[model samples]
Target: MAMIKTYRRDDDGVLHYREAWSEKSGVRTHMGAVGTKGRTRFHSTRSRTWPDKPTATEFLDNFTEESAADGYFPVPDDDHGWLVLQCWTFTADLSHPDDQRLFEHGQDALDEHLGWRGVGHYDGNDLGGKPPAGYDLDGTVMNLFCKVVDTGLGVKVVRSFARAFHLTPYHVIATREPGDDNDYVLAWSPRKRDKDFDLFRL
Candidate 1:
């Protein structure tokens, strides 16, 4: 059997997939890059980088299978317009017995808020649609597009979602617009939780 490895260049962070096999002489033969990076459905043509670790692993897995059959795998080229968001819930908190319920509530809130705006559901593992290739949501991650303008407004939207789901502001993992590397925390809460809740009547 062949051993496959996926790696990114330290200088440019471009991912490469390669396969290796050991010979009888204790020498390892490494195959060339299996797939050519291309524009994915969830990314732009110029951005060939993997959005997350899971996505990179997914690409490697698919490339391994296809390379075995055809000697090469074609990278997908489409942008699904969805951004991945990592969510954390205090499942062990005694006060939050129904963590799953809270999660569902958050999903519902987000859906209701963004559904009519062309956004999709809070998919648990998959992207809920044909997410190009190699772009799937993690177990605790959800995907959506923020068509809600700036990051400040995005934070307000997140706060509203948290309130609707009866969750603290910390539950939302702050993220930026896909492809941006700035310190734009999309999810934010007020300094004084109690005061903010009172002010917003949440």
Candidate 2:
């Protein structure tokens, strides 16, 4: 519990006061150094509490928040009726009653993004490819990637990299049994249904 202060050496060789934050209120207050001599001056960032932990979904939608802070998004689009501008991250307003639309439109935007070019793309790019420009890698990108696919495809893509992407089973978790794992309960298996299984590789 030491006091916070900024000290600058004066021409007289004595350290002079510059700034300090009191224990109460915790706001940064600056001191005037005008006319007073100091070799250099610097201001420390104000101390802040660790941000609240967000649910997985909240963390993923950060791109939208960042975009909104930059003066777009939360704007209304003409055809789509939401502020649907393209950015390194999406800026979707979840104010509507229909939340699933976020997933639907978000996927459409991500699909058209240059990063996912070519129809042949698969697990690796979705999991390992460069994130949208200017954005650092974090769960946000993966979450958005997860939403890019329609439900059937999304379930499959999410499976291939369950370990690599560090994804959990989520809704599928409670239903899964110890000996088996399948995102789609009806997905065909050779041993389970011999005649329906494809014998040759496509």
Best-fitting candidate, scored by TM-score: 1
Q: Tens digit of lDDT per residue, candidate 2, span 126-175?
A: 21222232334222222332222122333333333333333322212001
lDDT of 1 at 11: 43
Q: Per-model C-alpha lDDT, please? A: 0.36, 0.27
lDDT of 2 at 149: 13
| Candidate 2 residue spans exceeding 4 A from truth | 1-146, 168-202
* Cα RMSD, each candidate: 17.9, 23.6
Q: Which clashing pairs does model 2 show? A: 75-83, 77-82
Please, what is the TM-score per model?
0.32, 0.16
Q: lDDT at 202 for candidate 2?
A: 22
